[model samples]
Target: MDYSHVRGVDPAVADALEGEVDRQQNTLAMIASENHVSEAVMQAQGSALTNKYAEGYPGERYYAGCEFANDVELLAIDRAKELWGAEHVNVQPHSGTQANMGVYLAMLDPGDKILSLELSHGGHLSHGHPANFTGKTYDVEQYEVDPETGYIDYETLAEQAEAFDPDIVVSGYSAYPRAVDWERIQDVAESVDAYHLADIAHITGLVAAGVHPSPVGVADFVTGSTHKTIRAGRGGIIMCGEEHAKAIDNAVFPGAQGGPLMHNVAGKAVGFNEALQPEFTEYAERTVANARALADTFSQHGLEVVSGGTDNHLVLVDLRPSHPDTTGKDVEEALEEAGIVLNANTVPGETRSAFNPSGIRAGTPALTTRGFDEEATREVGELIVRIVDDYDDQETIDAVAEDVQALCDAHPLYD
Candidate 1:
């Protein structure tokens, strides 16, 4: 974690950088939206390409001296197209929100209706949270998962679409743990003459690896984060049919953002190329397997695993059923003290406020990236149950902390 050059220039910032590395190395990162990228990706993200300013697409850049930048961007675009089979790909959006913004910019006008899943029901802010620009800019309505089944009620969603008569119907999700029926969502969109935007931000790698069903062909617009399960750089990507290529491209650049992050694009190119390999398929599969193991372990420990289980790389645990007295925040804080990191999330039919929700969301991507298999992930889940069951006990916390350290030691990271 030496930052000699940065140390001389700004010691304060350099110290925080080293601390962050140490933190990632020592802790269990179960955050669903995060994954550990490879050394090659880190190197590419830290390259000199950051100094370049490529404002436009490959052949029609507004700036001069973009030969290498063009090469990296073109490679990323090609790899993305091959990975997802989208007719057109845009690798320029700085984040997933911007990616959604691009789609909205291309296909919608102010006050146009947007029907999407509700935030508390596992949708993202970009899908039209009141705090976000989308909610304010567009007339928004939201759908939800079936409280009984913990899955999207496609029939109800379709009915809502008919009533709303939206311009766009948004699919995919942020905290959802099951497979999406893209065909079902597309049918709803078609029946109402609405474009569908599927946000595969969390399951990008799973979809690319053919583990989860992809919405690329079914939805009119598909958006994803470059990192998460895919191991790409921290950025965003948009994919659509050739019919809307220019609209998407122009919307992403001039409509949503300025110059692209060329260094991140280079890193994305490297990561996408890595995903194209056969090993990534194994990694993707193991990620879901580990999550299933974790969910099984938690359920065996008497915690209510949401949806009865998970078919993806994450599990949402609603604490209200088992630990009726405990909030998700209680378990989350206690787990962090014992070196198991995850987030407290809002569950479907949430009774509590967003700040401290009723459920906790845990993921296996980062742990799987650190070489954890089903057994290891199951062990981690057991450790979580211990902390959640005895959060106030210092001895329990310390004992669990030791076990967490052993796991981190057994499968070291950033070495």
Candidate 2:
């Protein structure tokens, strides 16, 4: 963790780097899309492979002296295949969004139709938000979760799919909590002669550990991040059957990006190896159990838990019903001051702007990695409720900060 070499060259940047380590060690990280990677993975990502410029897949490189690069990438691909049971996997995209872009490029031409969940309802921007390239390039339509139950209405989605007749049907979500029936969505896409792309970026680890349903063999294409719940390298991955493998490979290489980040690919190989152990299954199960405990604690306090609970690692809490005057941004800032860190998110049927939405999203991935169980997670949830109930009270914030520090000390990170 020492940055002495960096300090010798650039003290300012080194100070910032060291400060970030201190921050993560002190505060609770409840951001649903984040996790703590092992120092082994970090070392791999910071290795000499970062300088390599391998522009093609293994055994066919666009540059010389790429033997080590090929070895790392091949290991990543093999480990990913074993982890997810994917027939074919591409671990080259720089991010999850780029993986989605690769799929879009490989399958559809410009102005093709795309049907995905609406962003405020738990969909990602790459799916079809106006601010992103996908919205500008394609004709996009969106589906929604049932307003009353906070779950995807498959029948309604099928009806919309039949009517819209999109080129691709996008399943999976960023915030919606219940298990998705991938078969139902696949059937809907098949009925309309459309391809199905399942974006499981947030639940990649859960799916790999058999804690959540997977879309590898069921969907035409699957995309995920290596970081989130997977706790791997900071990168994206794409998986498909052999029939579409060549197209995906080409789209990701010459179509979207040039050179692969070999250092990150090495990190992926190391982390995937770590995930294959028996301990990872236990980790995944505990992550979901901790989330359920957090949601139950929220419900006992009269806070509205989206979908009434969670099946995975995150719980979405809508504050509109219980605390009508409090914005999500208000609670998020106050919690940060209390040494708890999560994000403001838009809930289904959102009545406010995205910047200051009505909901807060919390997850147990980082805390679980730090050895937290159900009891500790519930205690954290109670602390969150305290902040939500009296966010502006400085004395309450101070008390919660002390409690959060105690928790951090008990579950020491990077020790």
Candidate 3:
């Protein structure tokens, strides 16, 4: 994708667009929720399907001129079903949060109770942060990971579910590193006679690649982002049993969303087709391997690695024990200056404000997408530790910045 046409029409907007492309080409993207999609997926996302207004599902539309739109959506849905092994799949949602919203609308009435993990403990806002509709519309209670181990306290969660007796129990997380025990969580939800909705927004690709335990069959509803680890175009997906298919489709169409982004649906189809290839499994495996290498590097350097290590594509590093005075924000800014882009994250049993949390979260999905292996990831990890160890050291920052550029060049995204 060339933005030359855009540059001819609108220079300023084209400049920013090209700058973003250059940024990705030149920098290391370690953000856990991000990945680099193929140029095929990009082309599809930027296709003419964006002009269509497909207001309903395939074979049934509320508008005319949707024959090709129907084909695109059906293809996306069919590929998604194969990818996640769901009896039913909805590919219409504009984002992961909307996918969750679709499930919520289908299953729970307003004012019903919701039990989910705390955001500070690695949960997402859609899982019931007070600011999101999940908290405001429903009665929300939170479960937490064990302070010492940085793992979910399943027994406590079960006990709390029995006590709170929520209508739905939400598992999965935004920053969790360890593999989730979906069956265990489902047992808790079953004991409380509650529905289990596992939000795998961060690990869609891992689940599809068989690199992580899937929640599709274990939970009553499984929601995910199409983009994160899935490397699909930016959208949301829901997987559920055949019994709930109608309700979910209705909830997504009439209840929550209007017209689906057909262009994004095309991208999802292309990406899912790519995922079904054998190389995608290799990519997923390499992603997890890189994360392990990153965790080992951080742990060896005396940083507190939450849950000790990772079984997935991300690692959480608590800065407290290693550098008690430094905040995650400080390291985030320093690393960004050095062109190693990731995010500050809140740790389990967090003592500081969420804005300036005590931890940094790193992931290897994007790096792995750029063809980085465990060895290359370890080098990146070593560079991160050095910067976090001395965030203000300009000489060290400059050196790391140069190295980051070299790594980016080595694994050129656009090329």
User: What are the C-alpha RMSDs, in order, of all predicted structures?
Assistant: 0.8, 0.5, 0.7
Better of 1 and 2 by lDDT: 2
lDDT of each: 0.94, 0.96, 0.94
lDDT of 3 at 69: 92
- Give the residue spans of candidate 1 off by over 4 A: none
Best by lDDT: 2
Question: Best to worst by lDDT, what's the order?
Answer: 2, 1, 3
Task: Tell me the deviation in Å of residue 322 in model 3.
Answer: 1.1
Please, what are the lDDT tens digits per residue for candidate 1 over residues 353-397?
Answer: 899999999999999999999999989998999998998899999
TM-score of 1: 0.99
Q: Write the per-residue lDDT of candidate 2 for residues 1-415, one digit (tens) a residue.
A: 9899999999999999999999999999999999999999999999999999999999999899999998899899999999999999999999999999999999999999999999999999999999999999999999999878899999999999999999999998889888889999999999999999999999999999999999989999999999999999999999999999999999999999999999999999999999999999999999999999999999999999999999999999999999999999999999999999999999999999999999999999999999999999999999999999999999999999999999999998897
Assess candidate 3 and give its TM-score to the true structure.
0.99
Q: What's the CA error at residue 52 for candidate 3, in Å?
A: 0.5
Expressed as tens digits, the lDDT of each residue in 125-214 for candidate 3 is: 999999999989999999999989999989999999999999999999999999999999999999999999999999999999999999
Alpha-carbon TM-score of each model against the true structure: 0.99, 1.00, 0.99
Candidate 1 worst ten-residue window by lDDT: 322-331
C-alpha RMSD (angstroms) for model 2? 0.5
Cα error, residue 258 of model 3, in Å, equals: 0.7
